[model samples]
Target chain A: MKRYTVTIGDITHVVDLQPLNDAEHYRVWVDGQVYDVALSEAPDHEPQVHPHPSTEAIPSASPAAARDRPADTATEPADLRAPMPGVILEVNVEPGAEVQRGDQVLVLEAMKMKNAIRSPRSGIVAEVLVRPGQSVNYDEPLLRYRQG
Target chain B: MNLLDTLLAGLLSLSWGQVVMMGIGGLLIYLAIAKEYEPVLLLPIGAGAILANLPLSPLVGDDGLLTILYNAGVGNEMFPLLIFVGIGAMTDFGPLLEQPHMLLMGAAGQFGIFGTLFLALLLGFDINEAASIGIIGAIDGPTSIYVSNQLAPHLLGPIAVVAYSYMSLVPIIQPPIMRALVSRRQRLIRMPYSQRPVSRRTRILFPIIVTAVVGLLVPMAIPLIGMLMLGNLMKEAGVVERLVGASSNEIANAVTLFLGLAIGATMRAEAFLRPQTLLILLLGIFAFGLDTAAGLVFARLLRWVVRGPLNPLIGAAGISAFPMAARVVQRVAQEEDFENFLLMHAMGANTAGQIASVVAGGVVLALFAAR
Candidate 1:
């Protein structure tokens, strides 16, 4: 059995597929509900193994060596997404600006109608990814925010 | 004494039918002012009805201003076409472009026009007359006038009034049918919004291409579609802002006043009180309901094939009431789910309905002319 995830609209569901003896029929479970889906292509299941030897034998004697490890990061990045596709007529917030919920962040012009994009939550603006007069695709991130 | 007695006797000779018509006119005025249903049109219509029905009013006589306005605009098919220019300028085709598939819904909605035509034919109207009456189902005023002017001029006044009246009632009439046809689950389906930016070049090319394609296919549609596309072209070209503004605002308002009054004046008691006029009204409602049902059913079929959030109610906005029907769809969707915003998608289908109604009008003319 193999598992896959599918997202439709805004809802996500995990699906499981089990191969049947007939080779054409696959038993699929979507969000715990089973469905019969046919396979149109052969499944690929081979896993590739890396052949590099370990390099941990070289020991470091420096006192600050433990602090140089890369995997101990604590902060999660903020996600900022565009509400609709349109030319970014203006960006009202800049990096490090503290914003409250419902603050106007950008203006999007679609179908000749101007729409003001507002902040979903309060935070400090961390980065602005677009500029004025730039056309943006739907759902493209226009800016990111982090805790002040 | 002899001359004064004769004049008084003439004034008293007015019939009860005319008096009743005057009262109906007053009622129309009240509805226009108090109820505020299409005040731009209904006010003038009500006023004209009152003036024309007065015992000795000269407003509807051969040389009167009302009659002259009628001859200048309605008789020559000038007002409706000019109004089309305004409609063309005001409409935005972005929604329709985002979902080209919704064009089919517009086509399905037009079943109302044909369905009403068939029913009118069965009710003893000749083919030409039936076509004009049937066009009232399009829920479009210009198309109604255009087709009726070409096919059956006599039915124009009643059909236009019926079409506009039913369009105003779309919010009331459409909800029941929409509720009955769609389930709660269907209404709650939230479609993810996906759209590609339509280039300015494409926007400029659209009106020209549509004019050529539709006009070549149905030459009879040239006047209605031609004027309509011309207005749209002016707006989209970006250089004719003045023309677009004038056509959408000044010309449209002026023509609406004249068109409404002219249509109202035609409702003289003797001409409008016939059983046939009542039948036209009833059939008009049937046509609108049928159009809405057809669009809903078609949308359901599309839903089966496509996995997304498409509210079936948006299909009902596929009539030519423009943003009004679209707004009604948004309201209905909000009732079902407060956060669901179906306005953009519904506007797309609504604009398609406007164009489709014009094509359907042309098709009707071509079909009749061929026979």
Candidate 2:
């Protein structure tokens, strides 16, 4: 459960969010009143790791929506992300591997077809976020590149 | 002395044709086991052929096990229709719903069926037999079996084999035709994924509406479409989870074995080793090529009029090989531009082909079955 403190026009409320079956659906409690919500589209670049809401969260925004800003803002270029939901069949690159744009980085099996995922840009790999056989949701980060 | 005479009698009666048929059966079994080419059906088919082709085989006479299964299922066309129920339950028409315009490609993908039908007639096959061969153009195994059993029972074995063999070869067969027809500039065209929110109510109503509309338009289509829609209705309703599970898994698997075996039994040496069998095999390739070309040309025509960023390669997916054809579209597109994701669009077309092929099967039967 992710807890947040909210102030809407000077009225404060305590919110508790609990994830349900999938990443999109959640059970949210606002001042002890509960409601189930489902997002129509999953957030494109939701950070795999979350910082606690008490420290860095804003005052009033729907916390989930807040995480879903423009995709280009904080995400560095060449940090490979899954374009669709699939299981990673193989990950060819490790940390610090030098790669060129359009080189095969990994193979992802989705819809029973093996999709060879290629590097979007030429860069040095900083870290690999996922390993072979890991099932990933659409747009989940696969690996990150070293920032210049 | 009696037991020895009985054992020697079996060897004495075996002919070259039976031996050749058994060898073919063994080859099919080998392909199914080693290569894993549509093994679920092929393995059963190979086994059935071997069982039926043995000299004075118990499985070949009127009261035989293989014949009983063939008469009960394939003879009446029950197995193929049952298989369609499972197919309907498994198919997700969401991508087609998201992009309704892709239905044109589905319709165009069936061009080879009619084209092949005419070719078969010129090659001296009777109208009904030609029509049966044409259904293989869609690469839809169940429909081919359904139509062939009804129209040309003699050709059922070869037609079913060709349909299944080509369906497994989808990845290998489709790429070259797709790459050839679509130039590099057209191949690189990117289609961004659009996830339209299809409502629960809409999903529930889709199957009912399709069954009614299609049933009325072509009454002959009622059986295939009705079963297909029934399965889809169960899936979308989500209330009949048990029924959906049974149809897609238990019932389908059981019937696939029966159907493949029955179709295989029809490949008795006398019926299968004909010169016309070779012609049917050649026409199978012709039909697939024409179907792919027709789809590509149709999509290119649509692009000119609609002025959308449509990739012609998605047209190849209109062949109704289900998700396989759709995946090939994605594979080929990524070959030219790795970022291009034509999967959703191709799936839309592929699913449309699923329905269109059924409708085409009905149309073909309506035109030629009685006459």
Candidate 3:
């Protein structure tokens, strides 16, 4: 397992990449939450790992993340949250679907307008948490991503 | 027997002109009921027209219900202003605030207003009357009524009707123009949604700043913009829930009914049935079309100038028909590319269009008032 810190915009994320069967799929830890990610292509550069500066360690288990995950270790995954309260109008992807950043994953109808919810990063969809016509609230788990 | 004869005298006194006006009222009622075109306003207007046209009807005579309502609100221009308060309460300016450049699209959309004004002039309409007729291009019902009521009171009925009827027909009227103006390649241009957080402080200050800026620049617009901003202030303040509720629902509904009835009451056959009315109707549609085209062309120019891709369809939302024009733009763009989502961006232009239309109305008033 190799840990790398990534920053986009103003938010910083610490991602731990664990190679599963091969270099193509990785078990990624964001903050303390685990996500299975499928790489669209092999990495050209090696991941840079650094020692924990402080004596305090990363939280052993993120309670919210652990509580939401099912007990199956084989299917440990990550989820996307709803941006706002709305009804799911369309789910554009299914399990095992590959998407790039900015690709629409689903559509949420809010304020009588349809808003496209996009993929935050390039990855494969592992599971869809909601179906069309289902009502969802702000920050509700929408779907999960996995590395192939 | 004497009392019955006296009561029946009203029915016996009906004129052919009044009967024709009643038939026109029926047509409006049918359009409202069957076609669902601005039914809230049209239905009340239709019923008022019939009531006023009745021989010796108490509803339209001195101190009668329609006359009283007209004098109390419509004639004095209170009803439309009250309706603006409701509109302001309901409107969300966040979209426009996030994308301030959409203000240009809003300004471009008013091109039709001026273009139609010139045409009305060529058609031999006096400057004041033509200006009132041109306001229909704004696609804003309350603004149209407010401007026409001030500049050309006699033209109010037809102008209000044309403005609203075309507004309801936006779905039908805009698509063809939108399709023809831009190539398919341009239509498929994708504009992804990007969320920009607007702070509460900014939201609270928006209405106040707009009121001062617009009020100073166009003093004629103060009454309309002032009431609209007042409602918006109450909503954003979050302390006046009851006021917001009443303004958006109860007061709006009440004023709409009064305004519609008063305007309809003015449509006695002798007043409404004229070649000028027909010309006004034609010119109204022309103004609407010109606005749509101008907005599209301006957006096309923007796409060339701006670095990012902007679906020109968003420009069509600049016609100030509120959510309807914006929705039509979204639907048209989606037809070409289902993955494309321009709703938030289109709404930005739409809200900008609303502001621009109000400003344009004030300008028209200013120009005519100058003389």
Against the unseen true structure, what C-alpha lDDT does each candidate score?
0.76, 0.82, 0.82
Over the stretch B1-371, how does candidate 3's per-residue lDDT look in tens digits? 88998979987788988998888888889999999998999888888889999898888889899999999998888999999999999988888888899999999999999999999999999999999999998889999998998899999988988898889899999999999998776776655345677888888899999989999999998888899889988998899999999999999999999988998898888878889999999999999999999999999989878765577888899978998888899889767544445677888899899988999888888889676
* Predicted candidate 2 versus true structure: per-residue lDDT over B1-371, tens digit per residue: 88997879888889899899889889889989998989999988988888888888888699988889988888898999999999999988988888888888899999999999999999999999999999999779999998988899889999998888888888888888888888766776666454677898988899999999999998888999999989999999999999999999999999999988887888888999999989999999899888989999898888877644677888898988888889989988877557566777888999999999999999998998889
The C-alpha stretches of model 1 lying farther than 4 A from their native spots are A1-148, B6-10, B307-309, B369-371
**Residue B335 of model 2, lDDT score:** 72
Give per-residue CA lDDT, model 2, range A1-148, as digits (tens): 6544432332334556788998767788866689887655544655432222211223425557644542122223546777666799999998999988677898888766788888866779999999899998766789998877
What's the lDDT for residue A131 in model 1?
Answer: 98
Winning candidate number (lDDT): 2
With candidate 3 superimposed using the best TM-score fit, by how many Å does residue B14's alpha carbon deviate from the native? Answer: 2.2
The share of true interface contacts that also appear in candidate 3 amounts to: 0.02
Per-residue error (Å), model 2, residue B4:
4.8
lDDT of 2 at B336: 59
Q: What is the DockQ of each candidate?
A: 0.08, 0.06, 0.05
Ranking by DockQ: 1, 2, 3
Q: How high a TM-score does candidate 1 get?
A: 0.75
Say which candidate scores most in DockQ.
Answer: 1
Per-prediction TM-score, please? Answer: 0.75, 0.80, 0.78
